[model samples]
Target chain A: AQSVSQHNHHVILSEAASLELGCNYSYGGTVNLFWYVQYPGQHLQLLLKYFSGDPLVKGIKGFEAEFIKSKFSFNLRKPSVQWSDTAEYFCAVIPLSGNTGKLIFGQGTTLQVKP
Target chain B: SQTIHQWPATLVQPVGSPLSLECTVEGTSNPNLYWYRQAAGRGLQLLFYSVGIGQISSEVPQNLSASRPQDRQFILSSKKLLLSDSGFYLCAWRSGTTGNTIYFGEGSWLTVV
Candidate 1:
């Protein structure tokens, strides 16, 4: 079974502050990585995903993530965050095999953006 | 546009009571359905997943069970609810076609007192 670990549990930042959240997954085989965000009272939205080709993937809301195979890590980053960026972030992964598509998620990082 | 619907965005039930949460997806067929539980301040735990009707897979043996009656409908049921089951229950689906993006529902918050 694959597991995802997120470094930060909670983060507080003022408007316009740069942001980066660390994520590491334990999967030895081919894997697909994703970064999801859940705003207050909203469904989880895809921030970005890494399947193949181009280790760097860009997502909605000016979010991007880099997949490093050797390190088994896919970290989310943003050049500048705003107050609207406050949300709960989750890192998820699934094996590239076709048997099952179940996702293993990280503990999540709560980001509080203050104006 | 494709949409996923989950009933009773918030639920409150007493311990030992029965539980049933329904989820349906529109604009898709033969989709892969999944049931996940998220405890407060915790990660998502996969409870069940179904590749097709009458094909259910249990990720972890616990107090919850899931069923897929139709191609786009999935249900999570419990014979007796437990306090530990108090959390956010999410139903998600992915296209049967070759893709890795999974869409989550609005989520059902269940509170077992």
Candidate 2:
């Protein structure tokens, strides 16, 4: 069984502030990584995905995540955040081999960006 | 383009009542379908998944059960509802091809009174 751990359960930041949310997964094999965001009262949307060939992946709304295999981490980051960026973010993963598209998701981090 | 639809966007059922939620996918074939429950302030917990028609897999033993009568149609049902079942139920689909990107439907809010 694979599991994801999100270190930051809740985060508060002012507009234009840099942001970083920690995510780590427990899987040894090759995996596909993803970050999804859910705005208040909105469905979950894909922010970005990492299949292969890139350790650093950039996503929508100026968000990015770096996948470090050695540390089993894929941390989401944004240089500058806006008030509209307030949402719940989820980190997910799927093993590359023998995967039936079952995605293991983290507990999620709530980001509150204040103006 | 592929899209997923789940019926009864909001449901309020009484304890010991029955539940039946339907989900279907369009614009794709032989895709994998899944059912997940999201409790307040928690991550999405996968309840069931299916690879093909009449093939279902259960992740956790709970009061819910899932079935796939058609390739793109997935159903979640419960014989008797429990208060613990109150949460947001989401239906998602993923292409069985190369990439592993899963797309979610507009979740159904279930409230057990």
Of the candidates shown, which would achieve the greatest TM-score relative to the real structure? Answer: 2
TM-scores, each model vs. reference = 0.95, 0.97
Which tens-of-lDDT digit does each residue in B22-101 have in candidate 1?
A: 99999988988999998987778889988899899998989998889899999999999999999999999988655558
For candidate 2, lDDT tens digit of each residue in A2-74?
8999999999999999999999999898888999999999999999999888799999889999999999999
The candidate that wins on lDDT is: 2
Cα error, candidate 1, residue B84 (Å): 1.3
DockQ of each: 0.73, 0.74
Candidate 2 Cα errors over 4 Å, as ranges: none
The 10 consecutive residues of candidate 2 chain B with the worst lDDT sum are: B93-102
Candidate 1 lDDT over residue span A1-115, tens digit each: 6789999999999999999999998888888899999998888889999889999999998999999999999999999999999999999998767767767889999999999
Cα deviation at B8, candidate 1, in Å, is 2.0
lDDT at position B53, candidate 2: 92
lDDT of 2 by residue, B59-83 (tens): 8999999999999999999999999
